[model samples]
Target: MKSYKKIAVVLTTLGVIGVSGCKKILDQSPKANVTPDVLASAGGVVGGITGVYSDLRNLWGTEGFLYYTNLGVDETLAGGGASNGGVAFATYKNYTNNVSDVYNALGGVFNIAYQDINTLNGVLQYGVAAFPDAPTRTAYLAQAKFLRALYYFHLVQTFGSVPLHTTFINTATLSDSRAPVADVYNQIIKDLTEASAELQNKPGENGSPFAGHAATKASALYLLSKAYLTRGWSSAAQSGDFQSALTTAQTLISTKATYGVDLYQNYADAYAPANDATNKEDLFAIEHSTDTKYGDFTPGASGGKINGWAYFFRPNYPTVNANYPASGGSGVMTRDIANGRPFFRVRPNYDYVNNVAFADRSNDYRYWNTFQTTWIANTANITTPRGSLTVGTDTAIWMPPYDPGADKRASFKGVIFLPPSVAAATTGANASTNTFFPALKKFDDPNRPSVNDPSSRPVVLFRFSEIYLIAAEAAYKLNDLTTAANMINVLRTRAAYRTTGMPANAVANMQITPAQVTLDFILDERTRELYGESLRWWDLTRTQSLIRRVKLYNAEAAPNIQDFMTLRPIPQTEINLVTQGPPIPQNPGF
Candidate 1:
């Protein structure tokens, strides 16, 4: 039971020795400088393991990783604030593998992942001797293995075949080659299988060890199922991969009670800011806190460990009054913590939101639950063209799912935002622009210190609800339509509008028969349940639907996306760093 304070001190000490500015994976010399003698003690082993956890902050919550995972796919497009590096990801315009270009920023994941992998390798190598007690040693080693598997899973999924290093390097190496995708999957499965067997089953955020945010048996199982599911779609897929995935996911689903995780009854409650740290639906999350020392980055600092997920998908709501001058001086809306800082980096794809994902806005509560439709007036006595807005009582901005006719929209007191179709056709102040779409409410953090500060909320990386989706997907692949429909119905039923005036048969309306279980339907269901959560690109790629879906649903990216783009270009920096041997080749057609 080492205190978090002690671990933070060790993390700081290791951070100094391990920090490096080199962009290439092979050039991470500082990590190699971490001597084994430093990791040979029990306290050192704990610190080293905590360092691996800290590395996740660099990826899970950062803007670069967010763009890599969420943009240029069917679900999202470039928004008003996407003029920066993010627009390339969203539009796939001039997106290339060159290390000198903005796309190279995405390579941060590759570098940070290997850095953590090397650190984990050191932990596993020295942890046994550091902790002579068998149980303590096994617990520490299991967590390291789980993290290693997670890193490899992300790498393989993103870059196709990445250089695999399972041993700690004490010196920099000049030559490395990409492993076969099949080999990478094999290692991922092996590590997760071992981790799932050895790790404890405690729920997340329960005040257990590691501030109750440690990886558990459920986390390992979830990744294992995903690994199998992804591998089943890969060229290296085995005959039993889909069956293995289905069985593995079903095991976690059936035994969720023992794992101390379950889906929230209402989807909105799962993402409520107050429930963030202790949300039962979250199987694993990257922890962030207000404590500047251990909370990764300072809450409002320029850089470090801030979770910028709150910023990226938001629409520029504060500019709504500027965009429409009808709402007088005190403005109908102003920047507020509840509405989130408007980066407007990524906007939801119009077709995906309006036509595909939330087609049943009447029956599905997910449409309203997932988006912020109204902004309550925080300013006092704001006058609009139609009427006066009283503070806290009147709706200052309304972004309804459907287009209320011009006559109906003119009757509303506050500003009204129609769908992109109407906005695109309109002129002057109300004309189409990236800032006025429906703001995603899923990552909104009302608890931030100020309007512009980054969120301290732990990014929910894996959730219990995804387990059901994984099971449903695996069942669909296996042609077990009955099991697939059953698994999906559980989530759909939960997504139904449960309010009094909503349809009493909402749950029944949401339920689908086995005949309705197509690959496309499952993909749509995933968008309904997990859109803008940073899994869309992987989801689209894993199912080989990236090109087709992007063309159909994402007008901005459809013209430029190519088959070769399925696997992002292996960073050119990594290729350049191989000075001793033939340089690593870029992904085909890069």
Candidate 2:
């Protein structure tokens, strides 16, 4: 809950700063006929193309807006913080101070996104300048356009009609008024259409990160299938377009015959470090390596510190943290408990896999083996770090006792237990808390505390699973049931699907079914599979199901939530920064 002003300090130390707002400035003049020497070099051009990906990260990672649009709108997500340290998270409980609130103005999301737009714009301008050949240049432009489509997709989903700027921003004609949502979608269609044509089976020779290397031409087609599905949802688009999305999705699925998208043998290996030997079955995923020899850990961390924000989820929750079960040490969960309550807790850096010992020892696969007190695996057993305490390995897991009829203490119980008030002094902030809400173990790069440390784990931004789901939803919406079902089954089989029918338990809770695989199912599947990946709120908002979905998920608490709580209040900082235009009007209820 640190201030945007402080946490994500935006000045790019990488000399890439001078070219933030406008893109064309970074590229040489087209009219000059200056006969640029670098135009012909593939290596230089390739490097510049890759720089676009880095720039994309740089733009979105600031201000946590990426999380705001996705997480803030959806009530399924609740900040674990003990109290309101800031505007958005605090108001999130009441559905107030949302990112789209114009008068109150939650400009954080918009600000960072604009920077992303500019960054993409610059990358394309430079990419086109460097690769002028028909095929090669088209491919790069397609990739640029594809990435631009991705950004715009998020934009349209979040704030409705946003300004569409194709040219670089420095032109005297600085800005365009908010374009119609249909116009924006049309532009997105144009980009993806061109990209699909240029990139189908284009192979790893080109440099677009996710859909470039290892991904076949079918990858682009599959993405187009999803894009078409998005178009299918809009009444604004002409007839048969939804069917087009469906057909594209089916066609791409048929390519599985030529180049299959199999699951990694072990369901757990999907979340392993990027370059793991077992890391096959990927169509495309965000590439991250712990940058040890280089300066930082993630794409941006530097100088042995967390200058840039790294996403965190509930340390104990399995759904968050890419279904790794016991990942992340995260922001704390708060429960008002002055009167009387009783619960135990943990901190963000550490994970508490299981407080209770499991009855069966045979079934300890991913979560238990990786980060829990695994009695299941004797080899993985953790003894006392310093020994001799009631709570066993004090840092690893804590099992503070409170029998069913035992006298209640001052702690309110929620999903993950919170510590009693008596232990509040211990659970404040310093990570000394032996009792409180359990910590999320996902983002902990223990030895590499500082961003400068080269060897830190990188989180997956997008992956093959997402591709599969996107294909499923897009195809399903287009009435292509077979392809949609197959796309979904790919993900299902990884978890535990049987030949004749899925196990009874497989359909138990949070499990996917043919019946549940509607737009809602697609959204929930995404939530279950890719929780912290930053797409939840956008998915909810896109379907206009946020209010109903959030109310259902959060009926136990915050039940009186209003329907209009969906759109966020735009940030005040942005309105202040703007030199022109009416103060951006917020969505009605904010």
Candidate 3:
């Protein structure tokens, strides 16, 4: 997007430099026009390194990875909600994931990650001190190292043991074996710890004119802590990883002011696009701009500025004819577009709403604030026996439990329709798309020229609130229940702020006890706070709770899920290309 002006030019430069490589970096064949010397130059290295951030944006900016990560989790489901689309991701949830589709979704993610790794290596090859100025050199190198660690962390988590590439190579190497998961964690820790020491502690662009999409000391530290926490959960994890994670998280929480990060008093304030730079809760985000006519699509073929992800979380309103015998439906559910295009790619599960959000609906504000239960009519296109529905004011559709059935179309005021019920009588074959569920409203972007146009809202990658969760989880693992409960209470108290009509101690009433400090409890807490974010799948996998949770929460994914479903299939292309050295093995049970 136009917002990050410094890196905008570098994105185009990547194409000119011909960042062309084989399936992986094994075949290092960049364009000859771009010699090593040119790349080694201070200016060239800076420009080349900017491309890596673009890759980050491309990787997380769209619905592809989000679909893979959030869909199969207990909180959300993949597939058309009251319509049809997103079947590929449904494959993952249903445990029917094959090499071709899984490869396409996650395979593409792997290639992009290495592409980023290669870019970072190219910059590191020249050495950080090579840059003209001392401060600039340190910043650049730190950013590259931070990203390298992040890429590897994602790889190791998603594919288990993966090919680890640290340095830039000028020649082709036929085979690369999967490094030990422990080895990958070591590298990640080394990179992050080093990066955090050298990076700045400045706040990112919440909405400032200055560039806001770079790594910071806090960002690196937070991720380092998270990395430690994730590694601690591994089968071959080392001793004291939980303590290490706890210490790091404690450092982050205690040093918030020094790091230029603090939890937002209001949850909605954290996501407001207009205040990206000013939002202290945001430690790092993929900054985007609405300046482009189409929106920033550099991260991938699509982005928040193009077919933005906001629409994917919508419900198929007009397509879902809840009003039978049309006492006249809200003229084809026109108002659904006001919430943005309804790709209806992802919908929250019933239990996520009823058991979690609605469990404390009186005291907790997250349920109402995070979801859209009502949708008004934006246009009038259909007619029935009743008078024509008015636009903007008439209720077009309403979600179930709130839907007021018996075909009262003329008087229907609530505007959103829910997906099919989880019960067998209604769930039937189209259960995936036929039910009524509240759509996620967190990514709302009404500025798009059309439903297909992407919103330019910056996709937040990390924030301060999650740090609390991390600390709580790490503490729970270490049996430090006091610290765990306190960390969780911070968020609970914040959420209770929305209990305006409820009791003064409603939020305080939401706090958990030491006895409630189980892994499942923490996971459920995470769901209430970070439902739509892409962390669900990783959370489920790391806890080794995929099968248990899938069976309990996700019906579509339960039957097919197995222990091996935790790690995705290694892309067949990578396997085929590696014709030498130890036969680059695919993840077990793929």
Best by lDDT: 1
**lDDT of candidate 1 vs native?**
0.77
RMSD to the true structure for each prediction, in A, is: 6.1, 10.6, 6.7
Worst lDDT run of 10 residues, candidate 2, spans: 335-344
TM-score of 3: 0.86
The C-alpha TM-scores of every prediction are 0.91, 0.63, 0.86
TM-score of 2: 0.63
TM-score of 1: 0.91
Q: How much is 257 displaced in model 3, in angstroms?
A: 1.4
lDDT of 2 at 253: 53
- Counting clashing residue pairs in each candidate, in order, gives 0, 40, 30
Tens-digit lDDT track of model 1 for 153-222: 9989988988888877767577788889999999999999999998878832222233356788999999
Q: Ranking under lDDT, best-scoring first?
A: 1, 3, 2
